[model samples]
Target: MLRRANAIAIFHAIRLQPGISQREIGDRTGIDKSTVSAVINQFDALGLLERVADESRKGRGRPSEGVRINGAAGLMLGIDIEPERLVVMSAGLDGVPLDVSEYPALPSESEFAGGVSAAVAAHLARGGSTLAEVRSIGVCLPGLVDRSGKLISSSNFRWGAVDVAGELRARFGQKVWVDNDARGAGLAERLFGCCLDVQDFVFIDSHSGVGGALYLEGAIYAGSLGIAGEIGHTKIVPHGRICQCGDGGCLSAYISGPALRDAFRGAGLVANSFAEMKALAEQNIPEAMGVLDEAGEILGLALSNFINLLNPPNIVIGGGLAVLAPYLMPPAERVLRRHALPEGLAHCTILISELSKEPHARGPLAVALQGLSQLNADGAFPW
Candidate 1:
């Protein structure tokens, strides 16, 4: 177990800091020199890492060799299913994407699968690589996925009891893994986002509905049944509006995109989308500010409770809500100051996701890379 942990740490160190020396890896990861050297040799034997003479540092004390990830060692595939599009990304071992394909999303599962398969074929054809050369495939679903990779439910797609992993494996003829899109997004934050240096954090993703993912104890913490971090259902108001989850006064009923839109309509205003509502707020419309202020307070209260309970060092608000952090975070911070414990509130920092493009696509790509890490740890080299 210790060896596996060291291997994973050394691998991530090289991945995060390419062209670093073995000694620098030991310094960064705090692994002893001998262990770092042993693990580097093992990775070299597996063709996962490469060491070359450091020409730039020729005058260094011992002329340390530079260690870097071998991007050509293997390839991983990622499929992200969104409401409007199906995204397929082919990535090298170094987590850099080689190909990204976007297709119109379909209503039926089989149709979506067909679209993904065709896109995969086109991606492979352009790269001159076959399915046999792919390491593994990771699928990101917008719903609750059980430990067995069965998508138990998805309110967005109205999908339930779907064997997503099995179906994808059957179609692709490779090892496939499935995870909740929100959890995958949190993983992306840890591996490649602002939270790379943070260990314990909470990720709140707001879309048509609000969801969350928790990183605890240096890994993704899906509770016993893999249904933890449903922050949307944390009740903020007693006997408040009814939520689709059959709960009253839940955070989802107050701050979800649909909830915000409905709040606008309830105030005798018409806002077909959150962007429209944001524009109204910019106009200083009384009704719009009122709704937003109320929603922010409720969200803040819920976040305060989360902070009190988990005491995570950081909190990231993403998805559509991130765009409105300017309006929401202020009130939310006020609530945190008022309600959350002083120590916890003082220690935590809230930030927005800084994703460049295809955020959903990036999560599944990270998931694939994480799966590769686990595979390596288990003495199973997919390459």
Candidate 2:
């Protein structure tokens, strides 16, 4: 068991930093050199690692070899099941995406599992790969997902207690992982996106609704019930608009995509969708600008509270909200400057996520990799 843990640690060290030397892996993972060397040798024999010439080697007696995960060793699949669409991505063990596909989601919640399975099969067929080649699968959803991979609920899809990981595991016979979409996105940010070097941060995804994830000490803090970081549910207004979660005065009730669109419609605007509303806001339409300005103030107020509580160095805004950042950030920043604590506001930087386009799809790759790290040589996860 200790050997397996060391091997897994070494594997992750190599995966996170490709072309890392065995000694560097040992140092980074805090494992002894002998164990690192043995694990590297085993991985090389299994064709799971590739040796590369270390360009950083200076005047040495012998050229040091660096190791990286073998791209052809296996594949990982990431599934992002949203209310309106399903996104699937396939990547190599080295974390390079090979292919990505998007499909419309089934309207009925009961058919979601079958739909997802069919989509996976189709994706594999399109990529000329089989399920047998997949090392693991990761799934993310816009809902409250328990640590055991059970989705407690999704207001968008009206789902309840779906065993997402078990369903996928039974269908494909591969190790499966599941988590909330925002948490998945946060993991992706840490692993591959803007927050790679950041250990503590807050990630907010604003699409159909707002969602948040907290990352502290280089790991996600899922909280006691595994449903922490529900920032959208934080009350912004007393006796305000009703939210989809059957709550009143939630932050999402005022700033979510539907809410913003509804706000525009109520003001006699011609906006049909969130994108159209953004276009109107871009055109300097007074009504649209006013609506966004109000929303931004509300959002900032909520962020100020978060900053005071968590004091995160970085707060990333992603999802559809990223597209509208240019218009919203100015007012939000002003509010933060006015309301937030001087120390916390001064230290925190709000960033627009570059992974906004497909974070949900990309994020599951991180989940899959994390799950892979727990498996032993015989493919059983002891924990």
Candidate 3:
């Protein structure tokens, strides 16, 4: 058990800081140098790690070798089912994407599992890869997913009580994992984005709708029902616009992509989509600016309430929200300064996500990596 724990620690250290020296791995993971060496040798023997020339070496008598996870070791599959599209991504254990493919989303909830299976097969065939090469499969759904991998409901798709994990497992005969899309994005931040070293933070995803995920003490807090971070549904107005979730005055109703576009259209703006609205805002159109300003203020009010309750050290704005950071952040920050508790506000820093392109796809990749790690810890890992 102790040895396994040490191996996990050393592996994570190497993963977090690829090309790290054995000594540095030991320092980061708190494992003894000898143990680190042994683990590195074992990993090398298993074809899990590769040694590279330490480029940072200066005035070295003998250049020390740096170790990193091998990109060719094996592949993990990530599937993201969104409202309009299904994205399938394949990555190595090192978290580098090998291939990504997009397809039209399934017509309805009944076709979700089979549709995903067909997409995965097509993606693998297109990439000249096979299921045998995949170590695990992770799925991201835009809805309420339980700890057991059951999707309880998704207001966007009107889906309910779907056994996402089981269905996928039956199709692929591989270990499968599932979670909410927003929470999956949080995992992606932890694995590959700005929050790599942050232990506590909030991730807000504003795309088709606004969603949130909470990461506390280095783990995602899914709450008792695995739906703890539905910040979008948090009531911000008493009886404002109706949200897709059938609730009035919800935060999503005010700032979601569709809502913003509709608001712009209602105000006599010529924007057709969220991207168009962003372009209009960039052009300094008065109508677009006014709509965004109002959305930003409302978002700020909700964020202020969130800060007061959680007091997280960081809040990462992602998805479509990141695109509007220039127009939205200033007003949001102003409201936060005026309304948030001083103590909490002082400690919190709001950051725009850096994963701009194919961000949602990365979430499921993190989920796959995390599921693989847990399986390894349990000694049930197949590859």
The per-model lDDT (C-alpha) reads: 0.78, 0.81, 0.82
* Residue 311 displacement (Å), model 1: 1.6
Report the alpha-carbon TM-score of model 3 versus the true structure: 0.88
| Candidate 2 lDDT tens digits, 218-321 | 56788767888888889989898999889899998988887887899888897755568779998998999998889889888988998999898999887767
The collision pairs in model 1 are none
Model 1 error, position 164 (Å): 1.8
lDDT per residue as tens, model 3, 1-383: 45655675677788877788898887887789998998788778767788987656746778889998887878999999998899999999887888899989888878888799889999999999989888778889888888777888888788777888778878876468788888888888888898877879999977778889998876677788778899999999998889999989999999888788788889899765556778999998998899989888998999899899999999999877888888888889889999999999999988888884344458898888777554243322221
Model 1, CA-based lDDT:
0.78
Regions of model 2 farther than 4 Å from truth: 1-12, 28-47, 270-274, 358-360, 376-383
What TM-score would every model get versus the actual structure? 0.87, 0.90, 0.88
Give candidate 1's root-mean-square deviation (CA, Å): 3.4
The prediction achieving the highest lDDT against the true structure is 3
User: Higher TM-score: candidate 1 or 2?
Assistant: 2
Candidate 1 per-residue lDDT, tens place, 35-130, comes to 988888877886777787755578867786888888988888888887667788888888888887777775776465666778788778888889
Return the TM-score for candidate 1, rounded to 2 decimals: 0.87
Q: RMSD for each model, in Å, please?
A: 3.4, 3.0, 3.4
